[model samples]
Target: MAEPSPPSFPPGNYDLSSVDLDDDRYEVKQSAIRNKYTIRDSTGNVVLRGKQKMFKMKEEFPFVTDNGEDAFTVKAGGIMDVTGNYAITDTGTSEEVIILGEDFSLFVENWTIRDPDTGEALATIQSKSGFSRPSDTLSPL
Candidate 1:
């Protein structure tokens, strides 16, 4: 059987300009066996945050929403997993928004985020998930 279609937005796209990284603090152990990165905003508000699991061969970075309401995590092995409600506001009547990813090659599986009204996809932000190599591309998390 064919897979179900992804949900759609109402009319306009969700504006991500309001999204900004305020500030961040991280700690690395002497052994470098484990590391934690916590990001906060200018007002000390955590916008996006994550943790790293280091190993001899590879590392994994998993992040979640600051409020802990929703989670969007990425692994060092190129695995991205997103869950929970991502908030957005629009002046328009349409209650839908678009979640644009950094690239097309990124893979998303076992992920779900949607608009409460229509149960449609508001946005999907992930590149790839699973045991894979990391890319040189640099972009905000």
Candidate 2:
């Protein structure tokens, strides 16, 4: 028999391949102090969990699979990096898979997702409106 899932993750056989290819809609939840975040699929199942320290000059978010295995790590730009970009590193390969660059804006945050190795743009995650951050990871999917 297999070991039971951890309390941090929901119970089920989480397939990362399914999450990467099939899933189109995912709800992202964040903690109030801006330290942790959880991503859920359209079926309202927790797919990924990420956390970082509450206070840091440069933040680093270590993400894990639903089964609590290492998945990826997102490191924020250093103090000298004016763009305030974030690099997503694949834990297994130890390579930067994606780069999220914060575009300067007067009112909202605009992020560009890029291919880290090739330096090619992939997609963009723009803040449509002011996000009313929740304290916990409980929201409608």
With a 3 Å backbone cut-off (N, CA, C), the pairs that clash in candidate 2 are none
Model 2 error, position 139 (Å): 24
Task: For each candidate in turn, give its C-alpha RMSD to the true structure in angstroms.
Answer: 13.4, 11.1
C-alpha lDDT (0 to 100) for residue 21 of candidate 2: 22
CA lDDT of every candidate: 0.38, 0.64
Top of the candidates by lDDT: 2
User: lDDT, candidate 1, residue 56?
Assistant: 25
Candidate 1 segments exceeding 4 Å error = 1-33, 54-56, 77-141
Residue-level lDDT of model 2, residues 6-115, one tens digit each, is 22222232223223524666677666565688988889988889887655556676888788888888887774343567888778767676688877655555677776
TM-scores for every predicted model? 0.29, 0.69
* lDDT of the structure predicted as candidate 1: 0.38
Once superposed on the true structure, which residue ranges of model 2 sit more than 4 Å away at CA?
A: 1-21, 80-83, 128-141
